[model samples]
Target: MFRAREYKICIIGDSGVGKSCLITYFLTQKFDSNNKVTVGGAYHEKQLFINNEPLHLQIWDTAGQERFRSMTPMYYRNADLIILAYSINSQKSFSNLPGWLLDVQKYHDGDPILSVVGNKSDLEKYRKVETKEGKEYAQSIDATFFEVSAKSGTGISEMFGKIAYQVAETRDRAKQNKTGYINPESQTETNKKGCC
Candidate 1:
């Protein structure tokens, strides 16, 4: 009788920052060299297991172009997590992070889990944005940060694993709060009876 939960995750960043590529690689485990840009937004899902409980991740890959900025909010509504991606090789992409963060805050209802991802980690040789700078910026905003290479499939599993665990914890807490269950002993029993 295990209950399944679904979490919505959104990715936002400047164009050519590899937002689409990251999602594509995560979903299919194959990188597209053509670099097809996302138009408005795209939705994808993956069924994951956290602590033996099923969790469905509804991932939204938003367009990074300015023309699609206005519609981005629609895709991020009710998102449990938001990933701010930037190319490590592009300083301009990193510089535009403030505006992107503002946009997410302006539209999302509450404090969703914000993750700062430095994409294109495989291009470290040409990197303009240092790892320290990206980490510091993420720290400044109190967001989780990871340097990942969608092209090389590096750090992808760890990042997604962290997201799944976090979102599951949030859901578990919400469920407990809604039922006013504060006793840890009873809570453990309730969880064992198939709540996740």
Candidate 2:
């Protein structure tokens, strides 16, 4: 019998970096243009399948405003993946990544999978953070790098799916190490909910 597993994910970044929109788009495949600033945090879930086994992704969209910074480390305590986001059009957002990284390093109990995500790919014309800069930063931090657009729903699937797979395999090394590894591409259910 295949056992079900739950994974925790936390998305953190500066305010107005499109963190909430990314979660909304991933769960619904629709752009949420009316998304407001996340006050403290919002939780969401998606049921996914990996190698035919059930997996539950418990996601948290944390508030990016400076005032909420002190409250964020608690969410980082037990995460399987942490997405550090920045708006491509906002250099300030990108520049603040190290501060966010410091929070994770100082508080995260386990070594979670990290991803540096550049949001607002749809606003490429107004881009302030170059692709090379993002890539180099990700490399320096030893994290996977991706560029996504919540409005256009681009690059979300590949980025999340790949990271989820890596986390799953790592978490179940003994079971999954039996050889003939199958690339279990993600299949998700759109269950609407929130947690904070």
The predictions' CA RMSDs to the true structure, in order, are: 3.6, 6.7
Q: What is the lDDT of residue 100 in candidate 2?
A: 96
Candidate 1: tens digits of C-alpha lDDT, residues 1-196: 8667889999999999999888878888888888688999999998887656689999999999999899999999789999999999999999999999999889898778888999999998999999999999999998889999989989887788787777677666777889987646434644444333
The models' CA-based lDDT, in order, is 0.87, 0.86
Point out the worst 10-residue segment of candidate 2 by lDDT.
Answer: 187-196
Writing each residue's lDDT as its tens digit, candidate 2 over 1-196 gives 7567999999999999999999999899999899988888888999777555678899999999989988888876799899999999999999999999998999998788899999999998999999999999999998999999999999987777777777776666644567645434322232111111
- State model 2's lDDT: 0.86
Best by TM-score: 1
Tell me how many clashing residue pairs each candidate has. Answer: 0, 1
Runs of candidate 2 with Cα error greater than 4 angstroms are 174-196
Candidate 1 runs further than 4 Å off? 1-3, 182-196
Q: Please name the candidate that would achieve the greatest lDDT relative to the true structure.
A: 1
